[model samples]
Target: MSSSSHLIIKNGTVITSSHQKKTDILIVDDKIAKIGNFTSDDDDAGIIDASGLLIFPGGVDAHTHMELPVMGIHSSDTFATGTKAALYGGTTTIIDFANQSRMESLNQTLDKWFLKAEGHVYTDYALHLSVTVVNHQTIAELEGIIKHRGVSSFKTFMAYKTMMITDDEIATLMRETSKYGGLVTVHAEDGELIESIIENNISQKNIAPQFHPINRPIVAESNAISRLVNISERENLPIYVVHLSSAEGLNCALNKSNAKIILETCPQYLLLDDSKYLHTDPLEVNKFVMSPPIRPLQNHQHLWKGIADGHIKVVATDHCPFTLEQKKLGLNDFTKVPNGIPGVEHRLEILFSEGYLKGQITLNQLVQVWSTNPARIFGLHPRKGDIVVGADADLVLFDPNIKHTISSKTHHMNVDYSAYEGLDVVGKCQGVMLRGKVAIDCDGVLKINEGYGHYIHRGACVV
Candidate 1:
């Protein structure tokens, strides 16, 4: 019932990216001390009989936005609540964005985010500096940010008017950051084309939620991806594409270029479709109103194939949630709605039930994409992703036979609605441990305090 300085997890099937084995894990303090069967000499060591369960490395969600300000209001979840929800869902670490304002420096942005998360989180977290403006000062700060500030990735938006930088600026940032061992990530979507479409739709009085996807068509996404691929080839830099939605966009990303393009997709794009936009109730339709809206049902096959064939590297939820009352701000006008949905707590279960149980991907592949790849890509490798000796003892004890339906009533995210409301899923996190401490017990009860999480200083990207 209480955390011990020494702990042993026995008789569980340990699932790794390469193999699965029935092993016993010994934890001393905050790290894995041993991985083979052994008896403890310490009399006070806590022991857990994990028979018939699967022990996995805790999830590393590489993309999330907690307390993000967009439109006219901030997101529903703060660091305190969002990280707790993530812990309950089996994710132990999340890489959140610290967006830079046009006038503020990168350090200033990071400081603000630190003030928000330092003593208020329940799971370990890191920050990715988002670049809204590319200037001489920004370029000069890259070295200090990467070398001293512990941030190794820079996120750039190719869509939003306030966040989008020019093609030249993106190239310059790639060139500048690569010098300091930093990776450049992008939110790929053609802004000008989408803006024009939105203007036309508004003039025609087609401002409903259905028109949201129409305004940002498939071509817009594919075109932006193509341009980014071309730039990556020309600049000879690796680029990460966030939330690839349509098959056309996937094809563009697969264009025969020498550049390495890492792809990440969310659960909504793989499981849900655009049909939700046509719901009879306008309030219900607004719930699916995220940017690069869900694609048609047919595109799901292509994305799953991408995962199976090893084209996509990671699967992360771009978790940004807004309450229904806030969604009403754009009830009649789709452009005014906050663009996000909550799925931080359902990623692992949905992936296991839909992808692994259905034979779309193996359990190793699920663990690879959901945990290992994200940690390696975001520079939190052996310490946060694997179950090897000397690694941090962040783990999940899962019951593979448990079947349950996901609903907003039982979820933990601060938002009121669930993106995957009625979907049935297999595999549940019965218990979770963070740094050898009992954070979630077998009964799914939270057992940690706020401020239990520490800020992780990451290294260079390995993938």
Candidate 2:
């Protein structure tokens, strides 16, 4: 069969956000054409024997940063490497953040990022504008930015005074975006409080990464989230909270009266903890430094509970990578180190082995938070998330019994190390198909070419 011919996936337990059943899926050209009990007799068809495995629509990670320039250094992973990592791990679509610097134009920023990704991507990609200064002109660009540019979601940061928006800015941006069929995403954290706490800790001669989590406590996150929720509820606009870290933050989201609010947490928050910050060799702790730093172990139960009960709607990697050398920029000072980790490649395996295999979450819930809901929330649904007819043929054949250890040596992300190194995980993705073609084989190798990915023009957020 030709590489682009119709393919039949036989006898697989197809899983969706809320249902699962043994079935065969037929892929024609670039979309799923049918799903039923059918045997292919034509020689021009490619067949995938998916017995004893679960078939899930490839993950649509709505949150990721590729080749971002921050802290005087660029993220270690470029679009090529990052998307390749995502594909190997069963993620076929990623919605990355396009930064609008303080004095930069929204259109220019979008254009610049588009150039960077033009010929370097390997899987489908989209963008969400990161709004730094939300003034009248910035607000004025909403129609062109969302409707014309096809980027319907905007992200507002609350932890960097130079970049973070105020309550007024948040309110104004939220009001305007919602009015125009757009959604707002917030990096919730009280920058003033965190700055003061960090300053106080430094004054006490506490210069350790462990102090990183101490200064930015759970309340810092909860306070910001609660305030945003209050504003969203009052202004009648929906908000998405990114990288929710602690129990308090989860509660603030869960207790919200606004059903439109969506909470996104990362794999690091679910699998790791503050204990890594307390390592004896203080220099080693730089690897784990991230905003709203990993919370205490006690917070894990609450996060898992939230994930299972549907309070949290998505699980993304945040997928920002900085090499150890880049991290050492803050060796003399913890505050100087870059704050983010790499988890793009391990999201599926980690969630499947830890969350599902351990009984912390269900298989259907796994499909929901990791793929369907993310696609729905980010406007990539109906095409990227489900296995139904007419949807893009982005799919993964997962072997629930394949056991392995995660390590940087075998991973595709361009970063220097793996945050999940030495971790044992079951349930690996054995085969990945993209647009009617085999993209990744059972040997965990790429079968597609670089620049094979198409730029997706996503619609506005709907639920």
Instruction: List the RMSD of every prediction in angstroms.
Output: 1.8, 1.6
Off by over 4 Å in 2: 1-4, 258-260
Candidate 1 wrong stretches, greater than 4 Å: 1-4
Model 1 Cα shift for residue 374 (angstroms): 0.9
- For model 1, name the residue pairs that clash: none
Best model per lDDT: 1
Which stretch of 10 consecutive residues in model 1 shows the poorest summed lDDT? 1-10
lDDT tens readout by residue for model 1, 1-463: 3454888999999999888999899998999989987777877888999999999999999989999989768999999999999999999999999999898988899999999999999999999999998988898899998888889999999898888998889899988988878899999999999989888988999988768888888899999899988898999888899988989998989996596788999888899999998887777888999988998999998998888888888999999999999888888888788999998898899889999998888888888888999899888999999999999999999999999999989999998989998898989999999999999999999999999999999888765
Backbone clashes under 3 angstroms, per model = 0, 0
Total colliding residue pairs, candidate 2: 0
TM-score of each predicted structure versus truth: 0.98, 0.97
| Model 2, global lDDT | 0.88
lDDT of 2 by residue, 1-463 (tens): 4566678899999999888999999998999999989887777887889999999999988888999998788989999999999999999999999999987889999999999998889899999999998777897889888878889899999998678888888888888887767898999999989989888989998877668888888899999988888887788778899999899888887676764568999889898999898787655788998897998888888898899999899998899998888888877688788878998898999889999999999989999988999898888889988888999999999999989999999888998889999999998999998877789997877899999998999887887
Provide the lDDT at 449 for model 1: 98
